[model samples]
Target: VDGEAKVGWPTPSKKLELYSKTMADWGWPEYAAPAFIRSHIHWEDLDLAAGERVLVPTFRIPTLIHTRSANAKWLNEISHHHPLWIHPEDCEKLGIETNGLVRINTGIGHFVIHAWRTEGIRPGVVAASHHMGRWRLGDDKGRSWGAGKAEIDRDAEGRWHLSRGEQQPYESADPDTGRIWWRDTGVHQNLTFPVQPDPISGMHCWLQKVRVEAAHPGDNYGDVMVDTDKSHQLYKEWLAMTRPGPGPENLRRPLWFARPVKPLATAYVYESGGTTG
Candidate 1:
């Protein structure tokens, strides 16, 4: 350690190494230096139709945290509807006016929501803020930060339809329920999204791309259309990316990565070589 040269960032050298010798030594010279790998969701690759755009799903508003804050009425009031943020230029190109409806089709399913044309977001990208739409089946009489409730129905034909009717003044210890305003409580679009597993980072990617379109007839605000069967199929496809065995590395798990409960060091070696410890 005393003789080791101090290095600053860019890895594998005393100074920033433009060419990573470590990667070259590892037989990946092409990726030894900085490189550009086009994203799978790049606009050029997609066979987009007239109204179709690409979705950028990770954007979030400051008013709320993830899914947990949905029941927080005050926070919901600050930012309620998770409108699909489209660019003004794109709206003109697609004939989609501000606050107009846009149907987003994912690999698994689709959902319809109002579009908000803004310059903050770029064209060719549609972003919906995270976690505004919290719903339960009509039977679950639970109340939360959300201002309204919804009804999800599956007819004999096996098609799923989601709709949120008008919220009536209700009696509750929380007076906020009576004063509850705003009709666009948003839709549960998560069900329509397909799982995207990252090939490089080895993390399950929540931000995914979806194909967008002009809302079809009967598509209303908070209206979501999805095929659960296709969702399962897409899940299977992503799961298929996983290796059959333990891992790419011989170790059970990476030592540095955070785990809720850490196991014995010996267990990390996997003496038995089965799934369990």
Candidate 2:
């Protein structure tokens, strides 16, 4: 028999064949190898041009520190701000001046961010960390503490009033430790990626091969369209299907309604049990 003859059905062997066949059907030739083997194509083989494709390693929002801990307040108070890190060279090529707002577009999607030029990043790429946008929960007067409350104003005439007051940023508190923190300081990279695969390997590569352009002055990057309604519907359906079942109820009550079960007892005793003076 040929060296490639079919072997007994092992789980790993079967998985490998299944993956290879799936890639073949999807037009991905580079990912047909066994899972245990390292078959990452060399960077040179991809013929990537400078500023064409880049690798971005992202982390969680710093305010939350971890996936489960982000909802806390104290963490957001100290260091939970988010910003996009971009190489100065890349900023220059896209006509994006330092610290200017720029839009990044890929074959599948796009996003806008305020550019931060840093030499620490590789020359050809940009990195946008996540978790900066947050709705303010009424707390303080400053823009960093929580979204400030909006008020309506009217002129001498009794016309309807509409005005958006500046928002105080959100401050997160750690549920377990009661520590307060800031939210904008965190890094959220997932927002910049797309749900696409590499053509050769069929490996899910979230980062996009895209271009950057300077956004018009006074333009807010968040206003750009990232996904269509159809795509959003698909994503919603997928989320509903994959989310875990609800867990136990939250037993901790809000601070305002807490009550002690019993009253404190006070004891008064003289030097002697009787009046011994």
Candidate 3:
């Protein structure tokens, strides 16, 4: 029996390897070493004078799942509004008062929402929980638990606009729908966000760099404006940052890596004249 301690990790070195040889052998050599890779919204990339702030959209309320469980009236009542969690300092700097309208301008569009100035959030950074702010175009009471009635329109400039109204009590199969007291269903902020996938990991980056300011005179409480064309352009830009597959061994991806729905071994191989499944 070996006398040495067997408490080491299961890694190749039997200990934490700061320099990952596995990554270097793979397509991502740049990530082989622990390094701080700058994000798309790096601090240096933002213009502080322009009211630019990083939007942390991945925050979630402990009482709610990610936009789910809306049918639970109790949960909806507790975590109803997904307001912009801004620092009081930033609010004062931007002239945004508590519960005041703030327009968050993303690359593709902007969403008008109420601002909650609290020290719980970091300065120069803002957050909006993922729960709530659901909307439906018509009177589809199917998801009426936390969803509000919204009017969607496209302008001549090919920009999409969604204006959500306050949630009103309505007659539904659930008797509780009629007794609904909370009218603030929150604003749909996702519509104004653009898809920013990480190049190396292929994960969606939820932190968005945006301009935060007081709402314009015409901006409504739940107003959302998106330019589909601009969104497409930004998508293409981020797509170009990624490295195409066919990594080591001519495989679409590392065979050891886990996939949601694993296909056949043949499907993982790169076929020059074939399209993705």
Candidate 4:
């Protein structure tokens, strides 16, 4: 059966042109559709990088909240850690088993994560999602469940006492619903990615061109690479703005006088640093 086209909707070619012009105006000529269409980089263009290897990270299902979700009864049952999804054929060559740990490396960075061998991905490429590896949840110093402990001192009478230490627990409440959720925390992937700007779009391309290797069990998945040079530059800029300098320059005289007083009489005496005679 043929489906009817919706009214007021632009044709595919027109839509493509609109997108191309919009992106071009935003300084993304390289990402313009005309260039992509000519180069045959369509939805099915995964294997288009044939004979050449590339690594891409995809986002995990919404239900899972990185490695932290593993502690939750509901989300853990679904899937907690991010596993690298690789083609079955690639697994055979590398002798990698499904659910085994592997080290994914790129020219700029690398991380050790679990591997999920499946036919869902294209060969010669590996895919991983951001989020996982929460260690502080169970640690004594970490506040995975609720607030930290407070110290209190009691007298012999046990009636009254002074409290010495007070530490608030890490708390997160949804702004819209007002429901709270807790977990020992960590920063997101944006911190790990370099601040290098794309030449054409002037946008930060967080995804890096990468490589992968097998990693043993119990490896630290939280470790990630960061561009220290960019971090240092950011720190210097922040320091300059915050440091204090000169105070205000101009001062204005009061316009009105109080009861039984004159404004001009006080102004002249103060300016000359003299006392009234």
**TM-scores across all candidates?**
0.78, 0.46, 0.90, 0.45
Candidate 4 per-residue C-alpha lDDT over 147-174 given as tens digits, one digit per residue, 9 for 90 to 100: 2232323345432221112222333452
Score each candidate by Cα lDDT.
0.69, 0.44, 0.85, 0.45
Q: Which parts of model 3 have CA positions greater than 4 angstroms off?
A: 1-16, 259-264, 273-277
Candidates by lDDT, descending order: 3, 1, 4, 2
Best-to-worst TM-score order: 3, 1, 2, 4
Q: Give the worst 10-residue stretch by lDDT in candidate 3.
A: 268-277
Tell me the TM-score of model 1.
Answer: 0.78
Candidate 2 lDDT at 114 equals 65
Candidate with the larger lDDT of 2 and 4: 4
Highest TM-score model number: 3
Error of 3 at 96 (Å): 0.8
Ten residues in sequence with the least summed lDDT for candidate 2: 245-254
- Model 1: weakest 10-residue lDDT segment is 242-251
The candidate scoring highest on lDDT is 3
* lDDT, residue 67, model 2: 36
Kindly indicate the candidate among 2 and 4 with the higher TM-score.
Answer: 2
Model 2: lDDT equals 0.44
For candidate 4, what is the TM-score?
A: 0.45
Error of 2 at 179 (Å): 13
- The TM-score of candidate 3 is 0.90
